[model samples]
Every structure is written in structure tokens, then in C-alpha cells.
Target: MTRSAPQFLCDPVLETVQVEHGFGTRGAVAPGGTLRPNQVHGNAVARFEGGSGVDPLEADALLSRIPTQSVAVVTADCVPVLVASADGGCVAAVHAGWRGLACGVIPAAIAALSEWGFTDLRAAIGPHARACCYEVDTPVLEALEGPFGPALAEAVRPTRPGHAGLDLQRLALEALSRGGIRSDHRGSAAAMCTVCHPELFDSFRRQGDQAGRMIHWVRPIRDA
Candidate 1:
């Protein structure tokens, strides 16, 4: 069966940079077999050093200084984050689901980009399950609040009697802030909830295993 091209959401902040980056919706086609990791909902980050062929390793984030190599991550309801240095020397793609976010994937990606001499980093948080529909039980709440403390806890509001809605965007911003990315360096989040907009995106929570995956990608522009 022929797959349709993915609908993409472009970040205006990232658009100002000398790089190509965007978040894909269902059916998006990634050029050049973009490097995608087998996200395990942990904080493991990998650095790509310009290689040939696709190597889908097990990791949640990917960083690269190679201008020709594009890096991406697949997600349904998970947050897809794209990062690039202000100078466009390096770029990174991260898949941060609630588990990955709680464990520190954003910080890990930032640290990796920092090691690549990318100090002034800019990031974009793509669409996912927002607080309006992302209700979680006590353990998930504890897992998020335990590591992030009150600020994150404050964002979690009771959705019902026992479940609370967690704001993944706020949590991701907190992690980015801790990693030294200021609000000015950040792009306005797409903010569309994947679960709420089934026509535009795929949601794992809504569609289960049958949900189609979206690919978010970034690449530095090589000088001719």
C-alpha cells in the first residue's frame, strides 16, 4: 500500500535558523531514511556522526553535527522535540513521552548538544496529549512530581476524583529551562493535542497499537 505524505507543523522559531526542521503528522515521509531510534521511554541519548544507511538503535534522543544527516523520532501521543543551535552547527531530535520526560530525556539531549559546542540552543515542543485530556493515576503523578517537585506538581490538576491531567509541555519547558534554554530561545509550542485532533495526528492512547506514527525531524543545512 502506498503511504501518503505526512502533514507537518513547522515551528516559526526554528524557521529563523539556517536549518530544516519540522514535526510530522500521520503518513509523513522522511527523506533519506532519517535516523530514528527505537524509543524505550528512557533518557538514553545518542549522538550521530555522519553515517550511511539507516541505523534504528534503541534510544529516546538523537544529536548530530553532521549537516547532511537528518535525525528524527517517531511518536503517536509522545512529545516530539526538535533542537538546534543558534548558529546551526548542531541539531537534535527527542521523543519524550511521560516516562521519558519524567526520567530526563530533554536534559540529556541538551547536554549532548552542549558537548557539541552548541551553547545558544533553541527548541520546539510539538503536539501531544495536553493536560486537557492526559489524565493519569497516582503512580504516574508521583513519578512526575517526585523528580520535578512542586513546579511540575502545580501543573497537574485533578481531572476527576483520582486522576490528574499532566501538562507535558510545561514539564518539558521546565527541563529545557534547567538545561539553560531560556524562554526567548524557545519556539511557541504547536500545542495541539494529538488525542483531541485525531484527523491531524495519531494518538496511541486513543488508537492503541493501531495508531500510526508521526516523524519529527531536523537537519543542519550544509554549505554549498
Candidate 2:
């Protein structure tokens, strides 16, 4: 990693690797940046050239060419993924919940940027529900296990006896690795599961039907 400037938002959950020394507030235009939010629950990725329109995308991942600008992904329990390839000068934000993880959204984002000559991209998995509290039905576990083998099965440990809890960020990390991103290029925020740490995070699982989502995004930028 080259150790560039910071382009993280004020919300604290969001993290970035390439664009540096900047921040943004929700609904406010990013200073010298552009923003996009993920629709999530789906495996779609949208690309933006210049800082153009508002609410321009309905996808799980967003990519931008504008340096210092950013695209945002909001989530409560889902994995908020920030990605960048400074060599290619491309950045993306992804919201990969369990469904999105099973649907292969991470690889889709990698493939989307492959057209732009982007390689050796770095990825960051933000705070979300870990295996500690992400209880799930058997179908979801079976779905994950069918592709990833026993490691995923082992990671999704049984909380009680019948139900299993999942490490979603691990799932996303596995997917990223399977997608060809090396471990050296991957970054993860330690601990702080949203469901377990309510004071520090906003979790749908913890907050129930009315939880307010936290947003994460990043973009390429030219120095001002």
C-alpha cells in the first residue's frame, strides 16, 4: 500500500484505501467528490464517469472515475465493502449482505472493473454482523456451504443447536479471494459487530424494523 490521503466519511463506519484526506455527510455532496448508495439485496454494479446526477443508480455496487469523490453503500448488518485500484485509478463501494454474498456480487464488481484495466485492487470489509450474532436458517447455511466447503460451515457456527450464526464479513472476504484478490491487498476493520455493539453501530438485527442505516463510500480524486 502506498499510504495515500484519507477519504473516509464522518460516520466512522466507512473506510477507503486510495482517495485521501476528505470526508462527506449523508445527502450532502462530497467535498471534491461524488457519492452513490447501494440498493443492496441484489448483485448489480453501476459505473459513473464524472460527478453527475443524484440518486443515479440502483445497484449493490458503485464505481467512479472522479478522484477524491466517492460512492456510498449503506448497511446495518450487511458487509460494507470499499475497494480501490490506484494503479487503474478506479474505486467502488459494495453492500454485500448474505443474499448478495451468495449471489456473487463481489466477483461481479471485480469483473466490472476488469474492463478498465484495473488489477491488484485492494478491498476493505467494514463493520457488520459477525458469526458471533448472525444467526441464520439452515437454507442460507447450506447455500453458502454448497460453494465454499466446510470452512464456511465451520465459520457459521451453531449458536444454539439447530440454528447457525454467520460471519458475513468472512463470507465477503472469501468471495473476494475466490474472485482473485490476493490476501495482501485485502483490508478489514477489526471487531465491532454491529448487532453486538449497538452504541457504536446501527444494526437492523439489533434495532429491528426501524434501524437507521450507516453509509460507506469512496471515489477517485485529483488533488485540489
Candidate 3:
């Protein structure tokens, strides 16, 4: 029954939300806009500053400085992270599935933005499978342990005392903390699990091939 807040990007200068959706697609919704989504089994991020047409920029994270430019990413069972500057008004969106988490995508994005001079950055982690239902195999557990660490292991404790479930959101929060993004300033993490809440989200793990995607978008809009 839970729902994610409709993520809207704003400059406070322009005052308009550029993109309407940020799900399962790869291309800008507007001219000066940019989007990238990938199926690769790792973490990566891209940045945009000016007008970028509808072209697929393959990456899991995106950042932008331009007012109307939109940087987008996609997800299914993964956590979709949306970040913004606490004082600078800049923003970035990321796709953080288990593999992406293992590859350090969220932290990498935070690090990249830090290089750009954003100190007090806020982040919001969107809907995805939780430790309550995201069970994994041995290889997945081992792989996740490398980047997610012992806490990640603990988060994925056995659901029924023998079977394990991975918490992608917890991994994301830990990644953000490791990346130096303060949690208090960060926004909300969608409580709805894509697998458990079939009515609201698209779950690759639970629904398999039948899951329909949801959008997580943010863009500065022009004032009327």
C-alpha cells in the first residue's frame, strides 16, 4: 500500500519538472536532456551538461548541471537512488540493483559529485526488493560481501532461519554512508517492496518476466 514520492527536479530558479518518467527507457525526454540505462552486471554513472538528444547513454548513474537537462537511470528489483545538492541545487539519479551495489555505484556517484564541490548532498533510495524477500545464492552472497561488507551480510539474514534474503536498500544506505553522504539530510526510502507489493511495483524476482516498470524522475522546471 506504500508509494514513492513523485520525484521532481527543480532549480528553484527555473521551477519546472522536466522528465515525466524515468523507468526502463534510455533517452532524453527533452532537448538538453539525457538518459542512460544498462543491463550490464556492474556499476557505472554518466554526466550531462548541455543539450543531449534521445540517445542511449549506457550507464547506471547520471548527473547534470544544466537547468533543463535530465539525467536518468532504470531499475526493476534494484534500488533507484535520486540525489540532490543540499545547497547547490544540483541532482543525480542512479540505478542500484544488487550487482550495481556490489560494484559500488552509489558511492561512486557520491564521490563524483563531491569532486564537483557538493558537500551537503541529500539522497533518496526508491522501491526495490528488501532483505525480507530478496533471497540469493552462494555466488551472489559472496559477490555482494566484497562491496557490501559484513553489514550487508547481516542485513541478508535468513528469512526462515535457513533461507537468506538480501536487502538492496540497506546495501544502498550503507553505500551512501560509505560514500560520505549524510543520512539525516537524505530523503525517504520507499518502503514498498517490488516483490511483495505487486500492486504498486514491478518485481523481476517475484514477477519474473511479467513485471511492468515504474518511473523515478527529477528535473528542474521553468517558472511560469
Candidate 4:
């Protein structure tokens, strides 16, 4: 893939609401006042009210009710999920890996955000290691089966012994579906495979711990 300016991908649903958001690429900078969690690959969420809370929250997701106070999550190969209400009064950023997914990060975050109200929720899954390059073993498969059930087979194709190519994006969409977001309402503006495009993304699967992470963020629109 050709390199572009440090930028972010926008979801049409979020655009309609005019929320300042982005699924970032390498070297990309998000909007101001963005707060990110430490991301332990668990389902926990750190929520902020009108004021900025402590930095480096020990959670996999960040939720913001303050209009200008944005929330973000960083990832190398793991999925970056950005969610918000239609008017952008509430927003969340999630770091979803196979572990987080199996542990229910998506639904957990949505359930947390729902406390504000579940009306017109929208979500977008960002770039990560795609199925074309993301392969998993039996234990990983078994862990995912709880959340994916019979549908898990659809996103998997046998690879090496005890391994299969897994579509992280498909599973992510399924998780969002469980959270009440329709297929059309869920966004994939930057669902490209991070492993496939080293020119544009930083992939841990491809570059290991040395690989850098990309930032994804969302901010509620301040009421006029």
C-alpha cells in the first residue's frame, strides 16, 4: 500500500453524527484531549466524566462522557474499535485482541456505554492483522468458540495442523452485533490487514514486540 499522510479512517455513520474520530495509521495523530488506557487485553473499561481522570488507566477500553475529552486505544496487530452515540455525547475506544474478544470486551464496553442510553449506537472496527495473515491454534480457537459458537467456523479455514486462518474483522462484527449495532450500522473504514501492508501499518505479528502501535480515537461533539 502507498504511504499517505499521518491520517485516520472515518466511518460514515460516525461522520453523520459529526463525531471527531479516526482509525489511525502509522505515525498518525488523533484529535486533542485524547486519553488512552494501558490496555491489558482484558474487558475492563476506564470511564471519564467532565474532567480528565488519571493517565495510563489499567484497562482495555476507555469511555468518555465529556464532549471534548476523547478516548483512545493503541494496537499493533490487535483490533482498534471506536464507538459512540449518534450525537457523539458518549464515546468509547477498545483494544480488542482474540483474548479481549473472548473475554467480551466489545459487549462489555457497549454495556458500559449503554448506561448513558443505548439509542442510535454506532461502531467501527479498525485495521489489524486480517484473516489473510492471522492464523490461530486450537486453544485460541477454543477460547473464541464461547463467543462465536457455531458461527466461528465461518470465519475459520484450516491452515497448518491445529491452526486456521481467522477473520478478526468478521468476529468483531459479530461481537458488535451482539451489542445491538446492526450490520449496516457497524463500520469498517480501516479494516485492512495490518500484516499485509507493512508500508501502511505496524504489525506485531509481523514485526513482533519491536513493532510500534497505531492510535485510534473518538471524541463527542460539544453541544452548540
Q: What's the C-alpha lDDT at position 120 in model 3? A: 66
Number of residue pairs clashing in candidate 3, backbone atoms closer than 3 angstroms, sequence gap of 3 or more or interchain: 6
Please list the C-alpha lDDT of all candidates, in the order they appear: 0.84, 0.69, 0.63, 0.87
Candidate 1 achieves a global lDDT of 0.84
lDDT of 3 by residue, 198-217 (tens): 65566888778876555565
Those runs of model 3 whose alpha carbons end farther than 4 Å from true positions after fitting are 1-34, 53-56, 159-163, 220-224
Instruction: Tell me the tens digit of each residue's lDDT in model 1 across 1-224.
Output: 99655677889878878678878877877777578887899998888886553334778998878888889998898888999998887889999988998899999889878777788988999988887778888888878877699887677887777788888888888888888998987875575899999888889899999999888899987761
Candidate 4 local lDDT, 83-172, one digit each (tens): 888777888899999999999999888988887675578899899999999999999999999888988999999988989999988888
**Residue clash pairs of candidate 1:** 6-27, 6-28
User: Which predicted model would earn the best TM-score?
Assistant: 4
Alpha-carbon deviation at 160 in model 1, angstroms: 2.3
Which rank order by TM-score, best down to worst?
Answer: 4, 1, 2, 3
Candidate closer to the true structure by TM-score (higher is better), 1 or 3: 1
> What is the clash count for each candidate, in the order shown?
2, 12, 6, 0
Query: Best to worst by lDDT, what's the order?
Result: 4, 1, 2, 3
Off by over 4 Å in 2: 1-17, 21-33, 51-56
